[model samples]
Target: MKKIEAIIRQETLDDLKDAMLNTFEENPIGMTVTQVLGFGHQKGLKDYVRGQEVITSFVPKIKVGFVLEDKCVEQMIDLIVKTCQTGNVGDGKIFVYPVEEAVRIRTGERGESAI
Candidate 1:
């Protein structure tokens, strides 16, 4: 299995959900969505704080993550990129990892089944 982590612009969340729902052949996979703060080479931008303008090194982002079967990884990655791209800076990033294992506590489903 593979874990897909997408750090995307907060504004794009709704579109991402819609696109994912429309594209996947299987039932919708479960996901974890988190609001986070960080910066890249962009280092955020200047913004007014306490009546003063200053470089804000940290900015808000939405990290959407889920685990998928190996066969679905590439297509899902393409869907994510297609749905999330804004042709601008701070569009965010994606990360993929090999999932050693996963489990659903109540159902006791593990591996791909757990997903």
Candidate 2:
């Protein structure tokens, strides 16, 4: 198993979800979506507050993550890039990690079946 995590622009969440749901038709995909604050080269944005300029160093982003079979990792990465890329600096990042194991609490299922 592998874990794929993507930090993406907030506006692209819906499109990413639709693409993943449509492409993975054979099996239901389980995922977690979290609202997060982060910064890259873009370094957040400048805004006016109370007639003063303010730089918010942490920008709002969406973190989408899931654990799935190793065979599907590349496919998911492609889908994420295709669905989220905007040719902009703050588009966000994708990270893949090795998963040691997985367990389903209700059924005591382990390994890929548990995923």
Candidate 3:
């Protein structure tokens, strides 16, 4: 199994979810999203505070992730990239990681079935 994590622009949530659901029709895909703040190459954003320039090192972003079969990781990443593209910086990033295990508590299912 693999875990796909995509940090995307705050405004593209609906579009990304719709596109992913349409693609994963044969099997249901579930994901979790969280609001996070961080900085990367863009170094965050600047704002005016009391007539003075202030640089904020942390910017808001949406983190979307799900654990699925390893084969599905690449496609998921591609969809995220396509949906979130804006031809500008801070488009965000996608990461894939190996998942050691998964468990469904209520059913006591494990492995791919648990996912």
Candidate 4:
């Protein structure tokens, strides 16, 4: 199993979700979305605070997390990049990690089935 985490522009969440659901309709794809503040190469955005120009170090982003079978990882990444890419900085990043285990609290299901 793998855990895929994608940090994307706040505006792209709906399109990404719709695309993922349409492409993976054969199986249940559970995902978690979180509002986060982060900065990378772009540093941050310029804003006027009391008429003074300022660069806020942290910018708002949407972090979407998913745990799925290994077979789905590549396709998921592709969809994320395709849906979120805007030919601009702060479009965000995607990460994949090995999942040690997964468990369903209600039914006691484990492994891939639990996911």
Candidate 5:
């Protein structure tokens, strides 16, 4: 099993979710979304108006995570990349890792089956 974490622009969340749902079976994957603040090389800055400056320190980003079968990793990554790409800064990132184990709270099922 593998865990895929994709940090992307908030605008792309709906598209990403729809694409993933179309590709996977109902509830075959579990997902979570979080709001995060961050900055990259271009970092945010303050905007000045009427001789006053307003600090804008960080960029808003959406982080999406899901657990899926190892075999599904490549496709899932592709889907995310395609849906999230904006050809601009702050498109965000994707991280993948191996899962040691997973458990179903109600049934106590373990391993890939639990996911």
Candidate 6:
């Protein structure tokens, strides 16, 4: 199985969730949301009118995650890219990794079945 993690603009969370729900069967997928802060090459610097320092600090972002079959990876990535794109900075990023194993808490089922 593959674990897909996407860090995206918080503003796009609702739309992304709605799209995923529509695309997949109910209960076949799981999702998580977490608040995050970070900056890229642009950094947190911003120009000021009076030459005063404006500390942007960390920018707010949302982290979304789920487990899916290998076949579903590309589709999921496409959906996220399409839904999250705004042609602007801080659009966020996506990461994928192989899950060593998964186990169901109640039934103790393992592997892809556990997911």
**Candidates' lDDT values, in order?**
0.89, 0.94, 0.92, 0.96, 0.88, 0.88
Each candidate's TM vs. the true structure?
A: 0.91, 0.95, 0.92, 0.95, 0.89, 0.88
Q: What's the CA error at residue 14 for candidate 5, in Å?
A: 0.5
Between candidates 1 and 2, the one scoring higher on TM-score is 2
Estimate, for each residue in 1-115, the C-alpha lDDT of model 4 and write its tens digit: 9999999999999999999999999896998999999999989999999999998999999999999899999999999999999999999999999999999999999999898
For each candidate, C-alpha RMSD in Å? 1.6, 1.0, 1.3, 1.0, 1.9, 2.4
Give lDDT: candidate 1, residue 44: 84
5-94: candidate 3 lDDT, tens digit per residue:
888899999999999899998897999999999989889899999999999999999999999898888888888989999989999999
After TM-score superposition, the amount by which residue 38's alpha carbon in candidate 1 deviates from its true location, in angstroms, is 0.4
Best by lDDT: 4
Question: Candidate 5: misplaced stretches above 4 Å?
Answer: 45-51
Clashing residue pairs, backbone N/CA/C < 3 A, model 3: none
Rank order (by lDDT, best first): 4, 2, 3, 1, 6, 5
Model 3 alpha-carbon miss at residue 24, Å: 0.8
Off by over 4 Å in 4: none
The TM-score that candidate 4 achieves is 0.95
lDDT of 2 by residue, 1-115 (tens): 8999999999999999888899998887798999999898998899999999999999999999989898899999999999999998999999999999999999999999998
Better of 1 and 4 by lDDT: 4
Write one digit per residue (lDDT tens) for candidate 5, span 6-101.
Answer: 989899999988888888866557689999988886487578989998878897889899998888999999999999998987788899998999
- Residue pairs with backbone overlap in model 6: none
lDDT, candidate 1, 3-114, per-residue tens: 9999999999999988888887467776789999999967888988899999888989999997988988998899889989988889999999999998999999988888
